[model samples]
Target: MAAREYGQYCGVTQALELVGERWALLIVRDLLVGPRRYGELAEGLPRIPSNILAARLKELQAAGILRRAPRSRVVVYELTPYGRELEPVVLALGAWGFKAMGDPRDEQVVTPDSMTMALRTAFRPAVAAELPATSYAARLGAAELLVRVDGARLDVSRGDGPVDLSFAAGPGIRRLISGELAPDRAISTGVVEVLHGRGDLLARFATTFHLAA
Candidate 1:
């Protein structure tokens, strides 16, 4: 089926016409972090039906928002450069929604991509400059993320690598990162386990990312 349109020529309406469908923006959100194979996308968006997922991918591809290319004989979906221009928009939306978020319901799921994006959105360069260069290995269940902080730059990528600090991602970890809970409290409660590196490094990690007051 063709995408439903508001039949208006305004830019905002036109943009929404392209991306306002159910699960459309969330698909873009997942792809923003990195290229994902079909199964990986499905895993990230477990609530979306397979048929709907397939259809949305096709629609986005046709609209020039995303494209599929083969990597090592396996096809992966990724946003085109044009599509990536939506990063600021997505991040802004995330920041705006942060204050409105009350709590996670039982059915709500958190994926690695969402966590990565949250880190990206929460990063504070001014605060990061106060700390020395460091790298973090974040393990959330079976997912691993490598976060590197150099000067005022912060980079997050998938997979494990040699790092200065390592910790498990959980509710307490999320709270620490978001400033909802203090680092000391999280550690004392055993919510965040530091597998490697000094406790100071974990303290610095907490300072780097935070939600706006």
Candidate 2:
């Protein structure tokens, strides 16, 4: 007598039925960044109707995938420790989705906070074993991006100064960070414009990580 089942398949289908919805995975992505208020969640994913988001949250809570935090005046959602394990799985799925599908975009609106949060979950440090002594800049939107890949570490900054290569990137920054499009293809095709420095530096820098999802 489980609560969720599309039919009598009753195995993994039960779990899938519980979590499978158009936007369910995104809800988990939002929580992976940090706890968020109901309004905050709405902000992360603007395309989801408020009512639908509410129902999805409730369904996930019932499935033991999410839990509600005690709020004095505002409602907040936090991932249960159980729910946090989903981070890697979702990242891997996203990685595969990007490799299979390439650049992610929909009419669906996604917030900067949510996008940055999602990017961080699958962060690829620009280097494999040692971070570079020199930093790099990428320009996106009105923001000047600062990226430092020191060996195993990544430090991102914001400014329009010379450090290393400069990139004129767009939303596909997600795909680049996830390592879906080979950096070579991305630059050569102008999907990502490297304005300065050595493209080989980035290619060398990009070899460290694979999107495990």
Candidate 3:
């Protein structure tokens, strides 16, 4: 089916014409972190049908938002520079929507990319500035994320690296960052494990990322 358009002349409308389709922006969200193979994209967006996902990928590529390139003998999808420009827009949207979030619903799923994006959106620069430079490796289920804090900036990337802290991502970590679960309680419940860092560094990590209530 042809993509539906608003048939309007406004720039917002034009932009929406390119990305307003169902599953379009979510695909963009997955690509924002880095390039992904077709299978990886499918894993990230479990609900999107394969046919629909392929169509959306084609549409996005044709719109100059993303491109397919060969990587190590396999084709992977990555955002074009133009598509990367949407990073701030997506992060801002995530922050804005976060204010209205309540408890997670039973049917809701959280992908690693989405969780990483949340961390990106929740970084507190002032808090980071007060803390020493640190690196962390977080195992969120099967996904491993490397997070580095330098001065007032926080960067999160996929995969592990040498770091000051390592912890499993679970309710405890979530609660700790949200300021609901106490650090001691998180440790006691095995929700968080300090694998390679001082307690104080873990405390600093907790303070650096906070979800707005």
Report clashes for each candidate as comma-separated counts.
0, 6, 0
User: On residues 1-213, what C-alpha lDDT tens digit does candidate 3 reach at each position?
Assistant: 344977678989988888889999989998988899999999999889999999999999999999999999999999999999989988898878876777567776778888788788878989899888999888765567899999898888877688988877554456777778777777777878777776556677778888755
What is the full ranking by TM-score, best candidate first?
Answer: 1, 3, 2
RMSD of each: 2.2, 4.9, 2.6
Candidate 3 lDDT score relative to the true structure: 0.84
Stretches of candidate 1 exceeding 4 Å from the true structure: 1-3
Q: Residues 1-213, candidate 2, lDDT per residue (tens digit)?
A: 654446666666765786678788889887886778988888778778989999999989988888888788766899988888887877777666655544445564545444444445445554455544556676654446566666767555444565667767676655566666778888887777887897766665345434542
**For model 1, what is the alpha-carbon lDDT of residue 149?**
91
Q: Over the stretch 26-55, how does candidate 1's per-residue lDDT look in tens digits?
A: 899989998999999999999999999999
lDDT of 1: 0.85
lDDT for each candidate structure:
0.85, 0.68, 0.84
TM-scores for the candidates: 0.89, 0.65, 0.85
- Which predicted model would earn the best lDDT? 1
Which portions of model 2 show Cα errors greater than 4 Å? Answer: 1-4, 7-11, 70-74, 102-110, 117-127, 133-167, 171-201, 208-213
Which of the two candidates, 1 or 2, achieves a greater TM-score against the reference? 1
Worst 10 residues of 1 by lDDT: 169-178
